[model samples]
Target: MQSSYNFWLVGISFVVATLASYTALDLTGRIYLLASARLRHAWRLGGAAALGVGIWSMHFIAMLAFSLPIPLGYDFATTAYSLGLAIGASYLALHVATHEALTAPRLLAGGTLMGVGIAAMHYTGMAAMQMTPGIDYRPSWFAVSLVIAIGASTAALWLAHTLSNDDARNVLRKRLIAALVMGVAISGMHYAGMAAADFPVGALCGAAKGVNAEWLATSVILFTFAILIVTLMLSRFDARTTFLVGAVSNLNGQIVRLATLDTLTGLPNRATLTERIERAIHSSRRQRSLFAILFMDLDGFKTINDSLGHSVGDEVLSAFAQRLLLCVRSSDTVARLGGDEFVVLSENLGSREDAGALAQGVLDRMRSGMWTDSQPLQVMPSIGIALYPYDGDTVEILLKNADAAMYEAKRAGRSTYRFFERSMSEAATRTLQIQNALHDALAAGHFTLHFQPKFHGNGNSLAGAEALIRLHHPQLGTLTPLEFIPIAERSGQIVQIGYWVVRETCRQIRRWIEQGLPSMKVAVNLSPRQLLQPNLVATMLQIVTDAGVQCEQIMFEITETVAMHDAPRTIEMIREFQASGFEIAIDDFGTGYSSLAYLQRFRVKQLKIDRFFTNGLDEHGAEGSAIVSAIIALAHSLEMDVVAEGVETESQLDMLRSMMCDEMQGFLLGKPLSADDFSEMLRGRMLTT
Candidate 1:
């Protein structure tokens, strides 16, 4: 018997097959991109069902297209069993195709299994016809048919692997082309298998409960299209959903970095540090161990910014942060608490000395120096360590104790580390009290200026006087600079207090000149904080101008340490002061390291020998006067005059005279007296040298 084909039905079969192939490619991409295992497994099962039905519909439809001399039908049970076989084959194919690594061996094995299943399903569907004298198979044609089916499955596997990427650009066009090739292969295998079978003449239908071919084809095609459409839509939706999830995760990471990191150094900021400290406390308590919170400040950082500008200062801070990271353990946390202050949280520390060693290591690194613009800069560190569960059990208390200890280190000449002591807390309390009292004193008009007369070294005439600040507290009584000066400097109260002294000195000078008293130059002590203040010369000039005193009538005295703190900046400020018609005096000389070069560069008018040398001068009369003589000669050689401080003894005065010092300021001739009392002495000539 001769068989014919329905071209329209055959075309529809190819369409269904192509759609299934494209859907298979889409589902592979969706499953591959999913990060959730459960989601991926769900898609895999659903995709298998969709692809299985599509392949089955195409096979059944193609079979229906083949007409014969006898009526065509399929047994219901056999038809259902063939559908199950098609589904099983599709499930295995998807599993192999969407695997992360579709190696050659894997593709070949999966292709063979799927090919065998398709062949069995076709043979099983053919058996659904249940003819009395079953159709016979031609061995050669059947072999060709099996070869075609296996080859089609392998090609489909390769195509699916190549094109199953998530990129949507031109994916549809590429997949459609790929699907056409795949559909043609699937159809070819089916038709070839059908051609291998020969129907005998007068074959009789055997199954009574078989389904009609038209109705089966129609139902399968419609069902297959619906599944394919929904699967493709779900694939697109899942891709977009996962991409959005990844974007949100990236955004959250950025936000966390911003909130917890320093803007300049990229180190953890105070908030992050606080959190870590709390965590460390919990962990250490559990382990019955200790950790340390080191509070550190860079000494003289203000001068660095002032002299080199903030840009270089920022570079220094960043480099300092990197160095801190290098010195600490990976488990430790180093954070910036703003400005030059840094806090290091070292956990699981074995002992207090271990923390001390860590701090000393940091100090040594800083001493080695850092470079910028091909020049090495000197930035020193002062660290204070507060041990957990000892210095403080809470974050606030620990930080407070550490800060107090740090200031003590700074006060102890800086460039060192200090452990927190119970006494430091008391000192901190007193400091707070003094700060409050200072505000009260400034507001309540309790501060006064006392004048100490300095006499010309060779004559009994008043040369100049040093203006000293005196504070008369309600309970502390009259207090000298030694009492509260350091507190003022540390609290930044010196800036304001220094201004008051400046203004009051100018006023006193004007008073002396107006009262027909000697209008000699008066020396005003300048603090390091005052020297670092911007526009200081201009500000003092304005104060002097307002007070109706010449700038020449006021002398500014800075210590040797202040001069050398930032030598370049100090020199520049001194020049500015001198240019504005003010003279600079190196007060308390020999108390700090003063190179000859820096001294010469100072261009000051005089050097005030410190009381240490002056008081010791007459002890041996010659050897005791050696440093005094050298300083006097150095001053003379530099065209600068010399003044002796704290010269109370007549022998000390005699030694200063022999050294040819330009001036002397001590109680030997006159002690510090109230403004009015000093005025009376100026008129009475009681301060005779």
Candidate 2:
């Protein structure tokens, strides 16, 4: 009788197994097709649970409907043993298969393997079930039983695929987690059906079939070995993969930082500067606000860098940049254009003063920095500020005007700021015009030299004549140096102009010397811009050598303001010139800082006091006399000669003579003249006087 019952169980199990296998194949294929590409990795867990639960439930329900003689006593140990083995083996298979690369062929082969495993587990579990007398639980009709088992497993699999394909999968960390939940649900349903099928009355009311000692013991051993192997594989995969991903991410961040940031100052570099400037311009136009661009340059920076090492220079620059940040409003943008050059774009300005005040604030703060390790370095920031929509609408014009103004500030005096002047703007336009005209001017030989005579006070004989610059405009008639000097300086044509001055001056001086005229020193004014050249001293010395003139015969005059602006550097240059056997004179002395010390610091052969001091002599009265006497005494103390400029009256000349001023230059002697008139004066003066 027991054997007959077992045969019936097997017979029903065969039909159920076929159904479970067919269901697994159909559902697995649907899940494979419908699940997201992203969640396809989770199929192993879902497929395993479906196959196991489908097989377990199919067999149990088939046994229940058959009314086969099952165990009368509780067979909890047998059923639990089978369930534990099926679940454990199915999980192991799914986990192991998931780790393999899931190619198209592998997925097909895996699904086929899963389908076959389900069929085998169902048939084998059915064969393991024992038939005994007096078991009350029985399966319902076959159609209803098949539907309950197969329909549930199919629904759970379909739901997982739906979650995988939709946005729901994004909520879970990995598709594998969602797969695990579905797996557990499917596993529980299958086990619940198993409990319903053939448990004793007390066991049926319990949560699950109670595990016997033998079943628990077997599960513990098998699960322990399976977990150990799985853990080992996971650890190795995690270590190598995590490290490689982390390394690649770190390297990418470093590369991005290098591309955007400056290496030296660690500021956003030129590439960033261009992008930001464009954006600022666009925003300004959209917002309808005024923006000011300030171009800043460190005055006399090259002197520090040349004398001191770059390390010290770099320290000074870094310190200066920090101070600059503190001076401006947070809204303003500051950037290092490169080297000692920096720029500031001040936006959202309510008034011109807002921009001006910000620029002035930056200058004040930059001046206050302790630049040198030895002493507090006083560096005047020469800033050029141009307002938006007023000075220029475009970034290029604003930047250009700001730069031009900065150069003008340097020319006026170091450590000062200047707004873009209309004249300067006009001057730039004139320069461009002149630059164009100069190419033709040089080719047409339109440049000429003029001379102004300087006489010895006591003898009234020719001491020397200064060579002046002249440009003959075809339409505008003759132009003076005042008209063209600025243009030449701006166009960087001063190098050519300076060379012409020396050559022409020497030529005139030599002609007079050949004509038996008195040998006298010819004074030539050298522009400060020309003197700042790195090779200026060398170039001048070469000029003197090439001209075949005695170095003493040609006097190179520089402005007192410029010399005092960079005293140490200028002193070094003056010493080089003096060493070359040339006479150095401080021109426009009184217009600058107290020139009383000029004779001592500078090896100046002559001092040309400015016209303003001379013009104010009568009005100042006794103070003027005292000042003139003091200047003459100061010049004599250092063994230097003094010249009074703008001596327009006999009284002015008389006062200068009484003060023992060695020479006088003004309208009193003669105005600057053509070279022919100057030569005639030299010739006529020697004959008459």
Candidate 3:
């Protein structure tokens, strides 16, 4: 008799087989892409279990689909043994594939093992069946089925390796295609192996002892579908998470680039340039090689910015940066130190001539003129070069010397370059010494205040005095203001010095008040840096309050240059002082570019004529007389008084009095004297009056 096949059960088996194949292939893909070694091992184990269970379920379901003349049941121990075989074989196969590159030899070996394992499991499962007669097989058909299993296993491994190496576009689509192909191969092998088996009819066997075929098929279908759904979900989540991580990493890289690169010119910024210089220094010291730093400042760029607009200026700068990059070697670095300033670093230089040649090339290119928006604009470069181990060894020293050389180049001519000389280093050292000494002088009370007495223009009666700073160094001995004031200003020590002046002047005024002397307004000079201080008004007021002096008896004097530095802030500060009953005077009035409009706006009490006009007045010169007359008239019209400074002769005093100047201060009156001498002068003036 021939065996009857259940077409309905066969169709159900095929459907279950397809689902199991898809799940197993997807799990294998996930195992390949996991990053962490431990995580990858875990995924490999999970993938092996999934594929083994899926294959075993497909084989068992197909076994149930086969028809015989009697009822069928399974042997529990034999059935479990087949499942263990499938799991063990799958684990070994995945381990071999993932441990390293799946070369042809390794792929073939792994496939052979896996194929033989699956074929054995199928036959073992078949042997578990208990029916009227034992199972049989056709030799040729069995051989054909075994060949299909080995061929499908080899193809599946190759496909997995190809998918793992793929990095082209549409990667997800490619993975899905690979999954489908793998599913078909695995399912085809299972069906072919099932067709190889045979069962004879009218055969007597032992009574059924295990689960019934129908119930077992139902149970296997449910379990296999559940595993398929879970595996697919995990695969999708892993892919999405991997994509998100990659995106965040890419964004962080872009942010770092933005921080270190100039947005307008795409050159390294100041901070990045500093780091490069430090690295270059380290490398040069190790190699015993020389490097050069070139500091370049663009000439006439500011003119173009003012004539056209900042947008055009930005375009010009960008074009200049590109040309600079082309001029430097690949090993060199070019950086922008903001607004028309750039630095070029050349490392491992053989000689100074090489650096000079590079500088000349840059200067020639800059003088050639740059084109922006089809318009040619001319700009020149002033380059200063400092060599390593010769000019200076450190970054700060090299850059500072280079800057001094650049300024010297500018002073010599517009378009030129200069090499740092030993003299420049000496000058820089002297400047540093002066700064250090000034700090010590301020702390050691080596600074003194000299009060120059001012007198009423019409009468000999004394007006207030002007307080001047004089430094008495133990070694340098009695340094004047012109010698160290500029140094203090440059080193940002002026703010502290200015505050000291205010406090000392207030203390002197308080002493006079305590000594039963008449109240007199003493004027103190304010530097430009002092006026820019944010707490200027508050700090001055606190100092005066601490000295127990009335604000009305103290006058603050600022030069015309200071007033124009930041007009709005200057005016605001002046108004605050005036509101507190302190007088504001514009010192060195005629020397600066003080407009009549600002003069009217500022709530000042007096204008001090510079010594230039005062000295000329003694000669009765028509020009000097006219200017003095005009300034006095202007002051009167603005309700401000006038003072004439540097009056050293009787003629000058007479001329100032004729001009109706409110106060006069000069050697002819009473030269700047110590605080004690000033007090004696005031007492004598009172006695004579």
Candidate 4:
């Protein structure tokens, strides 16, 4: 049967062929240029399949509408096999060309192979057609087909040469223009090949000899040349754009690295810790898994830092962090919080016991020795554990509870672990309240000074009164020294309390002077820790100057322990105080390690014999007397006056007087009295006795 054709059929065929070629070019370009990950991967195998199918489809479709001079029967298997082989050859050429310099010459070679394969398929399908009613399909002359293939391949190579120049590939916008030009060229080729398949019988079949063929071929040539020009101007543009994108991605990765990691230890820093903890908390809530919040603080880290330099300290911390990380499971998170502090957020915990076990493992690892050049760092970590849901439901509560438990471990003694406890909260709250109350008490005039008079042994004359600090608790009538001394020492409020006592003592001495009660000496006790301060002399000078009283009028009393510590400084201070006209007394003499050498080092005005010696002085009729006499004899030999303390009875006093004690003080003189009661006792004693 002879095939018939119409103008509409040619136009429709031209349109269909052009669209098919354009789609093939676009898909082919994008597969290498901008395909998705999966598509890019599949392109290794599916790419060749796609190219072969595109050639076969275009060839068959062109043949369907044709009447050729040389008719050829359709050979589906041979055609597909031929197309697949050609496609594979073209791909191999492209791959080889990519390994060499991407120059115009290389592009021409690769592009020529692709063009020959595509053109041969189109022309062969066009030539294998019947031209008359009696004609059947026939194969085209192989030599003639080969000549056509060479001519088309050369033309395509020249076109590729124009498009693959360095300048052309550098500009992205120009490369897009190149892609558009190549699209139009391929489209024009489709239409021209269609026209070549069905040239009129009387008309010359070659495009040079007929209006229809010549017009279509000329249009194809013009389109191809236009594509070549556009492509040549934009090739480098596309390459440069791709390179810039890769550079930007590399820089972004570097920036993220610097921001997330600790430079010293190579661990995740606090910034990363916050992010990881938030994510872990969110995931744990979803998974219904418990996470342990562990706080690790290095014991004696400050001593290491201070003694060996921060550089060595940094090295130690880095090494220790590495060891710490090794002890935990990969599922757990470890990060440095700063300086010798680290934190671990362990998730997927089966129970509190699991967390404890993990914590114990970390502690054991940390406790191992860290060998250094200067010293082997024997570091022990104080671990604080706060379990999820039990200790806290939120990050803030968990961190707070963990911190509280960490301090508990520190207080229990460093290098241990402590789970959070509820009682700590109550105790912390109460301690805060008491601290504020102490500050207010200093302002409110709630503290007072009282005195216990000591009588001289010879004339029973009042030699001095020992100034005692007393606080009147609202609940308990009058609280003595036992109730508040400890609280003062711990809170460091003793400095302020000591200041109050000095001021009150001076004020009372002035009151006694005004009342004509006697201008005798008064001794105020000083705590050992407070007296060791470098600024003690300055503080004393200021307090005495502020009181506007003679320093000699207010004698300074120091315990045996205070007098012994830093003997040289104590001696220097004693000389300074004496130069400023203040008497220095050694209190609680026998209770401490008393040395006559300390007496020679310090210019002590008096030694207050401890209450134990005085109490036992009357214990045995002979033995007690002997003991008291020996102590008084030792005091006399040292050239220091003696004041016997705890003189509770007439017999105790009688024994002290017999031993030649210089003075005596205790409950017998009267229990430490309030200022008003003491004033009354002074008035009665001076007026009647």
Candidate 5:
């Protein structure tokens, strides 16, 4: 009799095999995505066991689906052995795929081993089926099935490798397609192996009784799908949780960065810098080492901001921050304390020289100039350095001292660095005292003006006088301009003091006029802060109007240093004064960094030679004589009169006169006198003239 097959059983077998294949691939994919090595390894083994169970279930289901001419029963021992073979094969395959690189040669080798194990399991299960007529296989068909198994196994391995390595945007779609392909291939291999088996019709026999085929098929199919659905749902949940946790971590990092860093320059901000400085101090105390805190203020940045606009200023600050970063070590911290102020914290420094060198490097770089899109900008850094244990042991103290030292550097002349000194603190205290006293002095009317006469160089006739300020304190006796003028300037008291001087000078001029004395121009000095006042011109004109004096009778004197500090604004103010019929004089001409080119640009009536040059004229073969001569000539060339200051002796007078100086003022002529004395002298001089 011919053998017969059931097409319905074959269809059922293929569906079960497909489910088993899908379960194996899905579990293996989850194993690959696991983060920890130990967990991944554990999942790998579990996945292998799950797949082994699926494969065993699929084979048993297929056997139960088969309908034969004889009644069949299974040998329990042999059936159990075949199941073991299936599980061992799955473990080996998954281990090889997970542990080794997915190269073609390795994948092929793994596929071959898996194919041999699966083929062995299939035949072993067949041998457990007991019947009177034994089953056989066609040689050609068996070879075909074996070949099919190896080829299908290789394709499944390749699909899994590709899915695992893919990280493209459509990764989910690729994995789905790979799973479907692997499922079909695995099912096809199982069916091809089953097709190779042949059974002859015979009498019914039984070896060991087994469960009914209908019950076995229904139970296995339901159980296998249930396990697979649960595994997939858990894998998806794990992936989503991992993604959320990663996103939260990234957002937290961004928040910290925004809080601690400067938005414009991307450097650490004041709060972060303070924390770092505190930590550095603590560390240094334990290590017995020193470090330096450099306080930097960019010179002329305010001018740039006002002239070029804030946008350009921002770009310049960012560029400067970058350069500042390059000047320090990676271990050091460079922070921005807002608006052109930066602080560098260098810890574990060997000596003061290291700090000095770093400061110098930053200075050189800043002086080289920074460029933006529209123009090149140049700025100077006035750095103040304070060392640990020497300047201060605490954060607040060190920062305070470093700031004091920085201001000292600015006062000494900007574009330089200074270390903190003990005397600066004492000076600072005295400054505070003076600052407090000045407010009271102004309120109490203790300040008075003294007039020093200026003589014409050609003839000793009185030409003009400079109004000098003197303060009579109730407890301090008398304080000269040198003792209190700088305090006023630094404390921003010069504006008030300067207005007093202007008003008093005007009042003195009016008194002289009332005494029938010839009118003479009275020069009054202007502090830098006073010149920068927005209402400066209006204030002076108001004072002159209130004192009943002509603007021509008073001259406002400005030093070259003050004029050059903001040349454009100074020039504008000078022109405004000139238009109001007031005289502008450049005082202490040769002592500052102004070029002759800049000097010629100012609308000035006089250039006073500094006392240094005048005093130097008394020495033998004094180089100052040549300088004085040049200045006088330069002044005349600019259509400005020259005044020689501090001419103590006749020899100095002769030297100045020989240079054709227009005027001279010093003790040799007369000391600065009180308003009454000046009035009396002016009356006598008028009578003599």
Candidate 6:
């Protein structure tokens, strides 16, 4: 028996096979992305049915293209049974390809199993064509067909697994390419099976009346394509639905973030902070352990925001929030409580001192911090702490008290922390009183400078004088810096006060020069706020130039703490002062922890021993004398002069002289004097000279 092929119908079979393969690949991909097992299983079953029919139809079409000399027809029952085999094989293939973990062993076993199913379905379909002289299949050709079927099935399954989850357009192109390969392979298997069949010259087909081969192929082709096209349409709809579901999920996540996080810093917002604090309070009560709530406000943050724009301020706040996160344990919560305010909830603290230590750690970072580029801003926080079970048991009470303590810190002088005290609320009134009086005092000539004379440690020769700020209150008499400086600084009036001090220092020096007294430098204190002023160097230089006072007539004194706090910015400012021929001095030195490296980096000409260290120099050959002697030696080695302040005794003066200290200032030498008194003293000394 012999068969001739209609090449066109054969090509049509290949096209049907490619269509089925492509649909299987696409559907498999869609099914895997689904979150629900039921949805995946349903789509898998439907896809299997469509692909099975399509495959069966492709085989029938290929067989129709091969016309035997004798008539051929398929048994309805056997053919229906073959269809069931195709569907079952397809379901198994889909399941294996879509398995969650397609490891090596799993893929091998799954491919082999699907291969066997494909071989069974192919042989079973072949058996449906019953002939009077039953078809004899050649052993070699039969084995070859069986091998081709199994190999094709295995390769197709592997391709399905590999290509199904790829969602990109390139993946779709790859899938189309894969479909062509699998279609050719399946066609090869079918043709090889057809080649294996041997028919006698007189053989008669038993199922010749059952179904005409060409008609069956045509009918099934139409049916299979209909099923595949509809299945593809459904898959498209399902994919769209899945995409919408994913979008909704993302929207929900964003909504949750907006509710819980600060819009600016992405830190927990006030509500989230409150929730965490409440939870902590509950846990703390259960454990009978203490926690702490720290409330912090940026010192002078408003000045930066107003002067540099909110954009810069926002960046500073965000950076500070990140720094706060770094300062805490992962278990601790840091949150922003609106503008310039933040909160930290520290759990399992050992004592109030531990909380204080935590606050100090944050302060240290701020003290050493510069927040942006192109004129970096120095940010220091005034922190207030309220301990759990001591300050308050409830969240509201704790937060309230912490805020109150923060205000107290602002009063005590910003850039420091304060524990909640019963007396803090009352101190607020006094602080307010001082702040109110400061506005008029500068305008009314109540703000005055008192000059304290510095003498040579080795002799009574004058070295210089430090201009101390004093406010003459009509009702309360003269008040020192300790009484009102903090208030003025917080109110940002210190910048104006600083300018006034410079002008007055220059004026007084000019008067002394004109009065025939020898020219001497007078040191004036610079607040950090004043340093933050734009064009500070030029402004001070202009003031001095306008006063007819030489640059050498003024020295700027900065406390060692403030100078080293923001060292990079301070070093820059000092360079400008030095370049302008104004000498810089470190006031209250030895009080701050300035490393020798930093001290050398600064271009200061003098180091003013803080009163604390100066007071220590009472007895010679004592620890005080040794420390003073070491400091004087250290200053001299650095090519810098030392000024010992608060020298109130003859013994301290004598000790300072023995230590080779360069300058001394105290009541024993001369007290801080009014401008007139200092002038009279200067004139008398000039007369004596």
> Which candidate gets the maximum TM-score versus the true structure?
1
Q: For residue 601, give model 3's deviation from the true position in Å.
A: 1.0
Which residue pairs overlap in candidate 6's backbone? none
Compose the digit string of candidate 4's lDDT tens values, residues 478-565: 5567656655765568877887888888888778778887675778888755674567767777787887778878788888876775
Better of 2 and 6 by TM-score: 6
Cα lDDT tens digits, model 3, 528-589, are 66776778888898998999888888899999877875577778888898877788999998
Worst 10 residues of 5 by lDDT: 369-378
In candidate 4, position 224 carries an lDDT of: 37
Instruction: TM-score for candidate 4, please give it.
Output: 0.46
Q: What are the Cα lDDT values of the candidates?
A: 0.87, 0.64, 0.80, 0.65, 0.80, 0.85
> In model 3, which runs have C-alpha deviations exceeding 4 angstroms?
1-291, 295-331, 334-343, 347-384, 388-400, 403-419, 440-442, 612-629, 648-655
Give per-residue CA lDDT, model 6, range 1-689, as digits (tens): 77799998998999999998888888878877887899889988988999888888888788778778877777889888888878888888788888776777777776677666766777777777787777788899888877777788778878888887746668889989999998988888888888888887888878777755666777877888899899888888888888898899999999999999999999999999989989988988999998989999898787678557899999888878887887777878999999999999999988878899999989987677544443356778899999888888777888888888999898788999999986764565567677878989878999889999999878999988989989888876878899899779867899999999999888888888888877878999998788878699999999999999889888998999889877878899999999998999999988887889888889589998888877776543478777878888988889999999898988888778878889999999999999899889988997898
Candidate 6: where are CA atoms >4 Å away? 70-81, 102-113, 123-130, 162-164, 167-174, 204-223, 247-251, 254-270, 279-390, 400-522, 527-550, 561-576, 590-603, 613-644, 647-689
Q: At residue 352, give the lDDT of candidate 2.
A: 87
**Candidate 1 TM-score over all chains jointly:** 0.68
Across 35-71, the per-residue lDDT of candidate 2 in tens digits comes to 3555544544554555455455444544443332333
- How many backbone clashes are present in model 2? 5
TM-scores for every candidate against the unseen true structure: 0.68, 0.56, 0.61, 0.46, 0.59, 0.67
Question: In candidate 4, residue 292 scores what lDDT?
Answer: 88
Off by over 4 Å in 4: 1-433, 457-460, 473-479, 532-535, 545-548, 590-596, 609-633, 647-658
- C-alpha root-mean-square deviation, candidate 2: 14.9
In candidate 3, what residue range of length 10 has the lowest lDDT sum?
369-378
Candidate 2's C-alpha lDDT? 0.64
TM-score comparison, 4 vs 5, better candidate? 5
Error of 2 at 75 (Å): 34
Residue 18 in model 3: lDDT? 60
